[model samples]
Target: MSPKEENNIRVLVTGGDGQLGKCIKVLEKDYPTLNLSFTSSKDLDITNKKNIAEFFKNNSLDYVINCAAYTNVEQAEKEPDKAYLVNAEGVKKLAEICKKYDATLIHISTDYVFDGYKNTPYIEEDVPNPINEYGKSKLKGEQYIQDILGEHFIIRTSWLYSQFGKNFYKTILQKSTTEEKLTITTSETGTPTNANDLAKFIINIIKSASSKYGIYNYSNLGESTWYSFAYEIVRISDKLDTRNLEKADNYFTLAERPTYSVLNKEKTLKTFPTSIENWKNSLSKLQNKMYDE
Candidate 1:
């Protein structure tokens, strides 16, 4: 067989230090055709038009995987402006630059765009009715990207976590070790996506060179409550001292989350053919990684 043709697909990963970005970095070696450039918010502030222009002038990119987001749901309630600045306006700026540079954008979004009133899984065509600041900001970003560019993929995912960042997985692991008992809310429910899995999917799409550009939903195959997620983490860690409880309080959090926001992944699976693992199975793999560490 002849040597595989190098497409030399140049990709720019914003939020390079974030969980998903780190996962992409881990898998970079597997895709020899991809040449990736990672830039954190400090390196490339998406909100500042001048900064984005300057950076684009210096470097050329074929694709941009945008992971930078104002993700603090509760904090977003207090700092809505900051959230909009980063999540909405920043995304608009990035989309504009991508248009100017003729670059495709693969932007990360959230399942919180739904109001949780629907009993079934959310699809790509679902009308978004965001009830919180964070969700609204994210929806605005998605809108901007769609309006600005056609060569863009807006992937809406749920409950992304990894060992690399401050996510629910790391939080539960740390709490299980310190606290004697953990009381987590069961009212909210969503799929717990391993960032590594999502990262692999992104790279697979790039490698395929598919032009199936539009919004898609991706997450682990199953859904669970935060309480159940915590329990599994504690169990996998072999923490006998930790006790986990599922509780539902009216005012458990400053921000409201969807009681159920499982994303439908039919389009992504059909388009990319990436193997997706169940949430529990993915968690076990994460546990093995923790063990190795």
Candidate 2:
């Protein structure tokens, strides 16, 4: 075999139907040295150990990017057991399998792990004090990966959106067309991340084969409230006036979210050395891409 063929990396993306997974799929063609496989929960249920084991037995994997997660914060409050089953227990099983197979695991985490009590952006070293069930479950999953595996990259991101799946970006765009007035909350503060950029970052790590095994914070550079995000979305789509997007001080939610949960990307930038885009610019790019598609 040629040297390039010999050095090809094998990667499996779980929850392949998710926004992040689909975003990664869009970049699959760009990385010729990486052999990619995408599997939805129906195809490879991480919650089932035997199923994972059997699949691992058949396929030799170099890395596993786990995108499968129970992400509905409000629903997580009602079904803590289900959240833990997928986020914690399921992750533990996947980590164990990766360890057994000697494959590095790149697990996607959430900014919700932090309580959002701090005035500034959160760093990887900050103590995680989750305020809700979803955050708690995701934190537990991060713990499992840390304890069970030696080679792992735990990336914590916030407010992720993309062209492929249902997200706030799409919600705003849809609402702009139909709703005469939209009132969004300004109570919470966080960065809106473009999943396409995140997908590139993950692929870069794999391509570089960096052994910096630890947690990293990644998101767009700046922060914004839900109201600001919606405003920008409508403005970008040229429907702001028609939508009558208004800012509200409070919004009702079943789950308690961190008032502020922006992440510090200094560590990720210094480590990986990549250009991180501002949230507004990234949002515009995504909006343009959506229209083009």
**What C-alpha lDDT values do all the predictions have?**
0.88, 0.91
User: For residues 160-252, what per-residue lDDT tens digits would candidate 1 score against the true structure?
Assistant: 988887998998888767776677888888999999989988988788878889999999999998877877877877663434544554437
Off by over 4 Å in 1: 1-6, 240-246, 249-251, 290-293
- Model 1 RMSD in Å is 3.1
| Cα error of candidate 1 at position 189, Å | 1.4
- Model 2 per-residue lDDT tens digits across residues 220-265: 9899999999888888775456348878898999999999999999
Instruction: Give residue 25's error in model 2 in angstroms.
Output: 0.5
Backbone-clash count (model 1): 0
